[model samples]
Target: MMVWTNILVPVLGTASDAQPLSVAKALAAPFDATISVVFASPSASGLFNWAYEGGFGVTDVAVAAIQEETERGRARCGELLTALDYPKTSFETVTADDWLGLRSATRLADVVVWERSAAGGHGFFASAFQQILLDERRPAFIADRPPDVGGTIAVAWDGGREASRALRRSVPLLKKADRVVLLTVPHAMARPCDGARAVLYLDDQGVRASTDVVHTHGDASPAILDAVRKMDANILVAGAFGHPRLQRFIFGGTTQYLLESLVRPALFLSH
Candidate 1:
């Protein structure tokens, strides 16, 4: 069976209408299977940045702007999909309700592709979404391009659950990968998790894999970029290796590091 590759775009309850169109563009950008779009509805009221910027303290104007953005976004998405020469979609919407895990008319997603918006103060929601995708065992793509183009992939293998999860999730691109590297950071934790680790796992799964042992640079972000260039990899895969705030449950070093990085497209699987 073909693995599903998903593109998740955040509508932020404002520009959600554009999500399906964005997904369609991403899907058409590559030669692949199963492209999907997703939007999350706000469960609570929050400040509308655009509305606030426009000096709209009036509730009616604020409501109108949000609805208009949502409607136009959706219609544009449909038109884009049609223009791109894809079949008419049976599914598309802006909602927060749906069992994403089940095959339903409303949910036709296998993975999520989120927009990488810059952090607004504390980026808790994006971080939460990241953790959700990891926990769900689904790949998350923070897109730089419409659809994540898969050519070369860099796998940060340290024999951990998250790293391994990233590698496993990357199976869809592996088949079409021109090159792939299993980069190992010689940190304190280099024990093998059985053939369940990376190298061995990739072999068993019939994915083209190779390995490289390197010292962990000051931080992993730049090191990852160096590896990407050295291996000519466009996509980077790694476990979410960061500290989490116990009280707030916010992400720590490595997670923040990767997200802050503009080096390459990375797939982070959380533990």
Candidate 2:
């Protein structure tokens, strides 16, 4: 079994979040893990284009700020690791013209921690959360708050391939958590016993878990959120973009709801 030893956090120079690093440190504490903080800085040409396109007029100061931001990110990373008492931390700064290089960095980690979009900003990733959800083969932890360490974990299971994969990949986290709750909602093909099987599967892996069939009247997202609150779960692990791309885009989906509505419990999403 692969332990979450190498954690990667890619920071977007435009309003980044350090909570991901904090949460990763907490998760890695037991294993004495190493965190690699990669600062994705925009190229000078990219910054020049942004300034020119935005009618701000490119200036030496503007370009210099971009360069300085990368250094600031490195300094902050070191400070945060020291504050968190995590010594096995390393920092790297990469200048990427686009999101491609950033996406590639995701592959280098056993797991990735992503910060939710910041207000009045485009967020850490230039692309949609879907891009990371789909592109990264590893589990992506997206959260607005620091995830509760060793607290209750709520798994949103819908009996879909995406949900199953999320559950399977969640074992490492599950092992770390104090309790696991398998949360399921009604669907066309979903059987009540389905959640039970998930419970049994977790039991096989020595994860203490129970299943709850949450009843919801309207949009399932609210119900899912309700379940998380009622259970007081620290993290909500679920599948992302489960619907077909076109369908999900046209008519929003559960992942979209969780991202938009719930802000307390951190989201651990996978596809």
Of the candidates shown, which would achieve the greatest TM-score relative to the real structure? 2
Model 2 residue runs over 4 Å out of place are 12-16, 49-65, 118-121, 124-128, 187-193, 246-253
**Top candidate (lDDT):** 2
Query: How do the residues 159-268 of candidate 2 rate in per-residue lDDT, one tens digit apiece?
Result: 77777888898888898899899877764234444587788888898788988877665666677778889888999887766556423410124455566773468877
TM-score of 1: 0.68
lDDT, candidate 1, 156-175, per-residue tens: 76665566666776676665
Q: What is the lDDT of residue 92 in candidate 2?
A: 73
lDDT (Cα atoms) of all candidates against the true structure: 0.52, 0.70
Pairs that collide in candidate 1 are 7-113, 8-112, 8-113, 17-73, 17-74, 18-73, 21-77
Candidate 2: deviation at residue 260, Å? Answer: 3.1
TM-scores of all candidate predictions against the true structure: 0.68, 0.83
